[model samples]
Target: MFTRPASDEYIRYQNQYISIVPEGNIIELLERQQDDTVNYFSSLNEQQALYRYAAGKWSLKEVLGHIADTEAIMSYRLLRIARGDRTALPGFEQDDYIEPASFDTLSNEELLERYTSIRRSSLSLLRTLPITAPARRGIVNNHEMSVNALAYVIAGHELHHMNIIRERYNA
Candidate 1:
């Protein structure tokens, strides 16, 4: 199993996400999060899901969509790096993706189902990777990081947003 990534393995700013991830098996932590996040968001009604705490901020539904989109992106990065691809990858602007998605237009059940499928796919990919995959490195958006670091980023990013949903949106 992949261990916690060292600080140098990822971008400096991404450390915020990594920092909140408690010590444990990475796969287990991700599995737990996959279940917990789905359940948490599923509990919200339309009004609660539609909540946006401030002007220009994302609604809770948008935030959930962002989380899934980010995971899909990060997981693709992980796949390339783990498979020994050395091609330099590019970064995506979250805002650009969010608006077109129109997450608020979709039902909560639809959003939750999509998130569940993506998380399951992520876990399946993680389980199938070779042992050395974690140490493999690649350039992503002009920065180099390890596949393992991407895994942590995925987990940590979810936590970061969920914490915000709880504290900021209060949904």
Candidate 2:
């Protein structure tokens, strides 16, 4: 079984992401997330996909794209750390990524396709790592964190966004 990362594995503020992850094998959790997200978002109509709860909030399509984007970033970070790279990765600004990507222009199918493909690549990467990979650490946005912690953070970040998509977007 893949071990769950300890509290010391990540930053304090990151609990908002990691704390919600249910106990399980991290790889299985990721696969379940991939299936659940593809199934849930696939049912939305274009109207629902474009819905934004407030004028300034992201539309559901953007939310979905953001999830994919974050997963890709986290997965890259995990890959690097798991492979023993000590590179200090830069942090991304969420707002800086949105409008520039033009996620609002894509078909729901296109958005979900991007998500599915990225997630598949992530799973392939995760499956190859040595068991010792989880303990590997690297600097991200200036803070050191473990590969295991980043894996959970990726899943928790999606859960956080999915909650908003459910409650506020009402889809």
Candidate 3:
């Protein structure tokens, strides 16, 4: 089983999300989370998918899109770090991404398809990494990060959003 990342592997602010993940093999957790996420979103009806808990909040569709986008970005970072790239990567503002993507334009089914496909691609890439990959380190958003921490962030970020959906969106 893969071990949990050390505290120093990631920045302190990310701990809120990372701490949400239970102890286990992170790859296994990610795989299970993909299925769980897909299932949860699939259960929502059109109206439910569009529901936002309050004004100025993202709809369910936006949340799913955000999750997929985050996975893609995190996985990209993982790939680069695993490949021994020491270059510093820039960080993206989530709100900037959300505003232009027009996530709400697509049906829930389409959003799910996009989400599942991206997650599957991430899983495939992760499965092929060298054993030493997780120990690799790089800079992102000006913060030093490890490949293992990126994996945990990907999973934990999803869990964080899922909790928000359950509690706020009531989906």
Q: For each predicted model, how many residue pairs clash, with residues at least 3 apart or on different chains?
A: 0, 0, 0
- Candidate 2 lDDT tens digits, 1-171: 256778888877788999888998878888998888898888889988898899998988999999999999999999989989998999999889999999999999999999999989988888888878888999988888999899899889999998877787765
Stretches of model 3 off by over 4 angstroms after superposition:
none
Cα RMSD (Å) between model 3 and the true structure? Answer: 1.1
Off by over 4 Å in 2: none
lDDT of 1 by residue, 1-171 (tens): 587889889999899999999899889999999888988988899878998999999999999999999999999999999999999999889999998999999999989988888889999999999888899999998899999999999999999999998898864
> Per-residue CA lDDT of candidate 3, range 5-75, in tens?
88989988889888999998888899999889989988988888888899999999999999999889999
What is the Å distance of residue 56 in model 2 from its true position? Answer: 0.5
User: Model 1: residues >4 Å from true position, as ranges?
Assistant: none
TM-score of 3: 0.96
Which stretch of 10 consecutive residues in model 1 shows the poorest summed lDDT?
162-171
Clashing pairs in model 3, backbone N/Cα/C closer than 3 A: none
Per-candidate Cα RMSD to the true structure, in Å, reads: 0.9, 1.1, 1.1
The candidate that achieves the highest lDDT relative to the unseen native structure: 1
Note the Cα lDDT for every prediction shown.
Answer: 0.92, 0.88, 0.89
Ranking, TM-score, top scorer first: 1, 3, 2
